[model samples]
Target: MNSVVTRRNLLKLGLIAGTSLIAPRLFAQAHTNTQEIFITNLHTGETDRVLFYDQGYYLADGLDRLAWLLRDHRRNEVGGMDPKLYHLLFSLQQRYGQQKPIQIISGYRSQATNQWLQKNSDGVAKVSQHTFGQAVDFRIPKVDTQELFDVCCSYRQGGVGRYLSSRFVHIDTAGVRHWG
Candidate 1:
């Protein structure tokens, strides 16, 4: 047996095993269809349609477009959004099966913006996931927001909040919790 050949085979198996450890979702995934989402950033009044994931893989350009869209608008600062956040959005969109854009009230927030929001807003958290680019507050047009909140909660994905007055559902990757 050639030692080099054996080493090559082991390296291949190791790669396979390492890939196994990545992309394990907290929930069961049925990613058979192309994952696409239409988005509208309310603050920036910008819109983008992204085919973020397809064939069991997340596309980088699509994610980049998403992160760009999710940037803090107050100071025009961009942040690297956590990809898990996209997977959650994809799953939610899949469940709704709607073709309409996800109307975003909030996404990535700079610490300065967050601090300002905390001072001015009633429920803004000091350590919000938005600062970490791990959360989104959004609503679909013509969709019942209460029902959307219920749908977000049903997934058991992470922190889910229904702000009725604001008419948006907030989801985040930091905590497994639900709130109003």
Candidate 2:
């Protein structure tokens, strides 16, 4: 098979190579507060492994990329994502030390989308943290939902919702609480 190397493909290859080359150095500096996470939005099949924090600073471009990946798929809107939410995800990933991406069932929600969901759903909150980009419904691949919920609740940093039927745990940057 003939593989044509277009400019786009070349750029992609370069990015992959560059990331691989620097990954060792990046991970080496993980002790210096380098926070990274891999996320895959299940709704849109969008994914990225972003290094969002370094030495107590959140990288703007990385955060934007994450928000883009985590945007409202229904309405195609990108909201301002709270940094604390990213921290929560980072902590979860670090605790489990998983290589698989966090599969996001839901992320930011536009007001219209939230209201539509509220109207159609029985348990979706009328004032959801998702509207403010402060919550995420996600699950790790091959990881049990009960274990995920327990780990999240252990932090006691935010609201945790365990949806057993859906097999996703919702963590929000609201006051500490848990509900199934």
Candidate 3:
């Protein structure tokens, strides 16, 4: 005797098959537990690797800008970024899945730069995250801006501010919430 298959069972079988087919490729290229990034202090002429680990990334001395910027006596204030920020950035990078490095428009901001931004842009927050070395402004040249924002939003690690108007996203570890 032939048995009749239920519609629900067929749908379930199809979904399982589809997932099984796609799962391997996804797992093969899954996000690495750690990611390595090279950062250049254009002002200070220094270079360092920013390593992103599971919980967050580590900011090395070379990555820190206070020493470099202080040497040049520039009005730029540089400090090690919060680890949460790095993790957030890493997650965003993973979504892109491209080896293309991220371009930082601005990372740590000195009081002078903050003042300049305040005067220049109406959108600049008076009490910005830069004051505490918690904010990062960056862009991935070859990646889609909207796609980047969407990925960042997914993590909800901290504060993911999408600045489509300015074409750079602002990421911070601030517990406070603000996004555009």
Best by TM-score: 2
Which pairs in model 2 have colliding backbones? none
- What's the CA error at residue 55 for candidate 2, in Å? 1.2
Q: TM-score for every candidate vs. truth?
A: 0.80, 0.80, 0.63
Per-candidate Cα RMSD to the true structure, in Å, reads: 7.1, 16.9, 8.6
Q: lDDT for every model?
A: 0.85, 0.90, 0.62
lDDT of 2 by residue, 2-87 (tens): 35557779889999999999997887676359889999999898888998888868899999999998899998999988888888
Cα deviation at 48, candidate 2, in Å, is 0.8
Off by over 4 Å in 1: 1-29
* Alpha carbon lDDT at 14, candidate 3: 96
lDDT of 1 at 21: 72
Off by over 4 Å in 2: 1-32
By TM-score, is 2 or 3 better? Answer: 2
Question: For candidate 3, what is the lDDT?
Answer: 0.62
Estimate the overall C-alpha local distance difference test score of candidate 1: 0.85
Candidate 1, residues 6-116, lDDT tens digits: the string is 999999999988777764542225664577788889988998889887877888999889988999999889888888777777776666665778888889999999999
Which lDDT value does model 1 have at 63? Answer: 89
How good is model 2 by TM-score? 0.80
